[model samples]
Target chain A: MDIPTYADVEAAHARIALHIHRTPILTSSFINDLTGAELFFKCENFQKAGAFKARGASNAVFGLDEKMAKVGVATHSSGNHALSLSYAAGKRGIPVTVVMPRTAPEPKKAAVRGYGGHIVECEPSTSSREAVFAEVVAETGAEFVHPYNDPRVIAGQGTCSKEMVEDLGELDAVVAPIGGGGMVSGCCLTLSTIAPKTKIYAAEPKNADDAYRSFKAGRIIADDAPQTVADGLKVPLKELTWHFVSKHVEDIFTATEEEIVAAMRLIWERMKIVMEPSSAVPLAAILKNKELFAGKRVGVIVTGGNVDLGKLPWAQS
Target chain B: MDIPTYADVEAAHARIALHIHRTPILTSSFINDLTGAELFFKCENFQKAGAFKARGASNAVFGLDEKMAKVGVATHSSGNHALSLSYAAGKRGIPVTVVMPRTAPEPKKAAVRGYGGHIVECEPSTSSREAVFAEVVAETGAEFVHPYNDPRVIAGQGTCSKEMVEDLGELDAVVAPIGGGGMVSGCCLTLSTIAPKTKIYAAEPKNADDAYRSFKAGRIIADDAPQTVADGLKVPLKELTWHFVSKHVEDIFTATEEEIVAAMRLIWERMKIVMEPSSAVPLAAILKNKELFAGKRVGVIVTGGNVDLGKLPWAQS
Candidate 1:
């Protein structure tokens, strides 16, 4: 697969600009005082479909030709990507299908359906998901849009950092939680070319430390359903994402489960913003490594805000 | 007591401009669709000290003359007002004392001390609070800043609606949760003169519906020790706040406990913003009275975001 370039990201931004929300960047003096770092939160929690995945999903959905769009787009994600793609497809008046494990959270399934996506239930395994997804694509003759691996998706995700850099000039560092490395890769694709001076860091949960392990081993280290409060970071990095991660990422940091939950609660309490545990990983990394970030202007990408409120990490479930 | 005018609100805004945050105005398309009204949320939950009380507290602390300022300020409350006063006083580098019930939440007391405010514990009753506050004032010779009754504080809070009206030109209605009527009075003070055509609605929890009763009775029907999930709305309307409520407020709406909690959860899940139960009352009222607000542009004040996460209404305690 070809690696997405800055030009491709810029093109994606233009194509998806009208479809996706230009989310605001927020700051909290209380948090700044706590960490001694000037943190700028790119609040993609407020983004369309309540996540940054909306950008990539919208780009792919809208970029299709009328004939292709009529048949529509399909993906296999039970997370934000599924709902985001469905939302984008709905906006474009196209039929979209999401293949999800039968054991996926009911709320997540409901969200996909709410966005007008048809759901195809699969067995709870990687092989099963792939096998079921292939059948869906073949049956429907729909265009397959990979959540993060596709060049078009990476190009779309790149628009987040583009807007961040444009809004907040000359940040010392940019940080994001590394799930499949889509957002970080997008940041790398943009910053490495436009603002190369700004260091890029990816944060991961210690429980699901595949990206961190992968970074140190100088290769992709897949984890088999690693359990963590940050469900978003359980997935491993793909080739396209690894291409940007290995080349442009400064470091990948890990935060313990306790740290991730604490940081998540802190943002909710202080910044008055709702975010998923995955989004809190970057702040956790910053908190864990205070000396490295202190007195620096840092851009922290709040990846998404799609959580089961009833099953909040802190709430006794 | 002199009635606060738009001029007073404008002067208060100017005085507290540097000290308080001009919080953002946010809109949720999902919420707009749910209620069938164009809603503009004045996010005071994002205000300094995590509540709109910060505006009132800052105005009181900063408006003091040099001699009065040397002595500092004091208030008696166990809610957002106490912490906000402390925060405002800390900003001005002035000593402030809070007389709070010994049974007040530990987090609330901690926040007061965190902002460098001295705390004097009192019995959890209005009479006890007044007695302790008087003693504190006598001992320290500090200016007693009332929670809602004071003209300066009302004027300070009026700035919230002033900014809301300014941001969203010509709102059809302005809604706020009535907790001692401070925020609602502030809205009335500003809207009555500047945007008199805009109807003002006050929302209250049916469990603690003193403001609703008072508005209907044409006299203060104060409720003592009212219980509600919205802990912030337990306080009754004082004379000064009642003055604005009686004159300018079009109607006071009450939401059942279930409706308030549901509205609170909806905002958190859909809007991805952290707001306390008190803040959700206005949205609840709008949902209940769809006919009054349907197809109209309404400005809703999100009162505060200082709820105890451990004891969240949805969470099992």
Candidate 2:
């Protein structure tokens, strides 16, 4: 299997430049004061569909050949990727279908429908989601776009870090949340090529620390059950993503659920940006390991801002 | 009294350009579809201390002469303005004393202390705040900076629209929340001069629609036992603000408490930004009166994003 390189990421950036938003780099003195680290936040929360998934989805949809494109595309995601794929396909006037778990947030489901994607509801379990998605692909003959396991998808997600590095100059390290490891894997590849000395790290919720364990054990590790406020990080890493992460990623760190909630509230209160728990993972890691990052220049990719306002964790607290 | 003309606002823009953030202009296709208006959101939520109050505070702090600067500044505010003044004054190596209502959010009081401001808490009444602030000014000889009723502060707030107009270019109309009318008054002066044809409207909360009623009465009016989710709009309009607003403002619109909550939720969900209820007032008006802005280039000032996360009004629903 061919892997995505920095060149592929650069090409993907060129392809998606016009379609995606060049999200701004945000910095907060309050955050810097607390961590004693100069942090640059690559705000993909402002990206289309309010997440970085839009980059990969747009790249995948636009990369299809005329023959493949005629059949449209399908994906199984209960998160940002599903909405992003639906949005990209709708923009191109292509028929799209989304297989989502029944337990997904109503806002995410509404967003998919709002973007004109056909919805297939499956039982709120990984086995059910995969089984239902297989049926969706077979019935419609639609191209299956893997959320984070595909090289093209990883290459597209790399564009976020490329834009960050270009805008903010060289950084000592780049950190992003890890779920299926697509964003971090792509970030590692891009950073390794352009800023070879820069360390790349993945932040995962402690409740869903499969990636952290896998990184330490030098093998894939799966979590039977995950409970994290960062719903986006519940999935275990895939084979293709694991390959990139094992090769290029320097470390994977885990943040407790409390840390995640605190980070999310800090961003909301101090930075005045709506960041979901997943996006807060990078900041949470930095805060939890402040000693390591003190006085260092760090770049953190805030992945998404698709949060349920009424059910905010802080609100419950 | 020398009223701030368009020329004064233009000069103020140059004076405080270095100190204040040139906040970004945000556009959303989803928001456009919801409101049926091409909207440009002037994101003052990203400004220092998470509000446009930073613009006025920076201007006031920097505009002070060396002799008066030695004494520093003092203000009475229950929210963003207090924090903004503290931040601005602290940056200038000047002492600041903030007289806040005892009922102000604990987080806001903490923010004032975090920014190195001396806080004096009084009862949650205007008379109590005034009395406490007067005592503080008398004891410290600090310059009293009224949040909105001051000319210098109004000119400073005007810079927000100045930057917006420069970035967006020739908007058909401008909508901003009216709370003591500082921001709207300044906006009216600036827009009436630069984009003379651009209509200016003030969005007021239905519970605290003093400006709306005052405009209708052709005189300043006060609300009795005003109630609104927009905590910032509780203050009654003063003489200077009323004068500018009455002369230049084209119309005033009111948003219900329900509409304000819904608009706040929409901004959080769709725009992925943390907007306080006061900030959502303009959006609430646009969402309510879609026909008035159909096909027109509309500019809305998102005043601030300092909502207390723990006490979010929509949490119950």
Model 1 per-residue lDDT tens digits across residues B276-311: 999999999999999999999999999899888777
How many clashes in each structure? 0, 0
TM-score of 2: 0.97
Runs of candidate 2 with Cα error greater than 4 angstroms are none
- Identify the candidate with maximal TM-score: 1
| Model 1, C-alpha of A292: deviation from truth (Å) | 1.6
Highest lDDT: which candidate? 1
lDDT (10s digit) by residue, model 1, range A61-115: 8889999999889998758898899999999989999998787767778989998
Computed on C-alphas against the true complex, the DockQ of each candidate is 0.90, 0.87
Report the CA-based lDDT of candidate 2 relative to the real structure: 0.88
RMSD of each: 1.5, 1.7
lDDT of 2 by residue, A1-317 (tens): 77888888988988888789999998988789999999999999999988999999999988889888889999988679999999889888899999988888888888899899989999866678889999999999999999998888999998988888899777998889999898998888788888887889899999999999999999999875477899999888889999988998988899999999988898888888888899999999998889889999999999998888878887656
